[model samples]
Target: MKIQVLSSLALVLALLSQGCVSSKKYKDLEASYTQLQEKSRELNQKYQSGQQDLSGSSSRVKSLEEQIASEKANVAALQAALDKCLNSSSQGNVNISKLVDEINTSNKYIQHLVNTKNKSDSLNVVLTNNLTRSLSREEMRDVDVQVLKGVVYISLSDNMLYKSGSYEISDVAGQTLAKIAKIIKDYQGYDVLIEGNTDNVPISQTNIRNNWDLSALRASSVVQALQNTYSVDPKRLTAGGRGEYNPVAGNDSEAGKMKNRRTQIIITPKLDQFMDLIGKAPEKATKAE
Candidate 1:
């Protein structure tokens, strides 16, 4: 009976040992499973954070693309505005240049008129001074020379020039006319007018009908002496008869009638060049083309 009891005790010891080993293994497996669960949660959290960052980055990229597109459109518009502004500025500059040219052309034409007038006035001064100094001879003492209102008036007594009721000039009168012709020839550009005057008288001679005829014939005689003898230009001379009219004082006095018998020479400058430049500019330009 003692042997049978020991065998049963050994069997019970083996069963207890197996039960303790099984409990230890179960605890170790549970700890390992808990660690694996913690690791899986950490991994899932990292993936979720990565996904959120990617989504935010994509939205930012789309916004940047839209901004770039809007900036390109604005740049195009600014470029067009710049080109148009430059074109208009160029045209405005052309118009300003053209206006300046027109003003300069007008100024040139106006200056031409002023130059021509000054030249003419200077010539008149030269002519007036020339005649005053030349006719200061002793033989020409009775001859009167005066420039009245730019016209030269020369007066001589009829007693010194011709006989009464006769249209014939004396030798002294011919010499005086020769001196006048020399003076007129020295300077050019003069219109000479010779006038004759007679006192209140009636005449009926050969080719002498009245006082008018005598006056005309006497004027003609003086003109012939100037042109034929002294080489004065006939084209520049004009003869007229006063016939007791146009007396300086009165026909009742012989001295007044003698004073009225005078000759005039008027000189005038030709303004054709000045007038053509001022009045016919368009025609001149057309001809130039």
Candidate 2:
């Protein structure tokens, strides 16, 4: 019995020791499992961080690439504009040269016109001087010579040219007419206009009707005398009449009436020459085509 009791006690002690060792081993396994779960959580956090950094890098790379593409397109556009300018540079130079030539031509034409005007003015002055020098004081009293607007106007009083109320020229007028014809003949480039002016008195003479008819007949007679008797060129003469319409003074007094009755010989540069000069520029331009 004593031996059996001792064996039972030993068995109980051994079983208790085995249970303590198993409990210690289970605690160690639980600690190791907790450490492994902590390590796993840390690894997951690192992976998520790496994914976010990669996404940000991709976005930055795409932005840089898009910027580079835009810059390339801008450079291409600038190159195209430069090429276009180079292609058109020759045409621009030609247009500029043509404009310069046109401006030069216009300047030359304007200078030509100015020279012609100056020549005409000088001729008028010379003609006026010659007429004034040729006339005597007595002749000047009957004749008035004036230069107005590049024209020479020689006014002869009716008393010196014709009898009272007559269109026929007086015999004394022949000498003056001959001198005037000589002057007219000297200026072959000028044209002469014989204009008759009369007072407002009505005419009752046979073969004459009114002031108009008398004025016209008087102008015609002077023109014919200048052509036939004085040997002035008929082609250079023009006849006209002004029946008291153009007056130098008031017609209320006898002196004014006498002043109103006169004949005017107007000498001017031939219009044909001026017209031909004016037309020449356009004709030259047309021929340039």
Q: What TM-scores do the predictions have?
A: 0.49, 0.61
lDDT of 1 by residue, 1-289 (tens): 3344455455546656677546665555556555656676667656754564454345534544554455455545555554565568555666655544544443443444344444544454455445544554444466655443234456666666776557887776766666677877865666677787776656768878888887788788878878888888888777888787766667667676556654433344324543454465522433322
lDDT of model 1, residue 236: 76
| lDDT (C-alpha) at residue 76 in model 1 | 57
TM-score result, candidate 1: 0.49
The Cα RMSD of model 2 versus the native structure comes to 51.2
Whole-model alpha-carbon lDDT for candidate 2: 0.73
Worst 10 residues of 2 by lDDT: 280-289
Q: What is the lDDT of residue 185 in candidate 1?
A: 80
lDDT of 1: 0.59
lDDT of each: 0.59, 0.73
Top TM-score prediction, candidate number: 2
In model 1, pairs of residues that clash are none
- Model 2 residue 253 lDDT? 92
The digit string of per-residue lDDT tens for model 2 on 238-271 reads: 9999877888988889999999999999998898
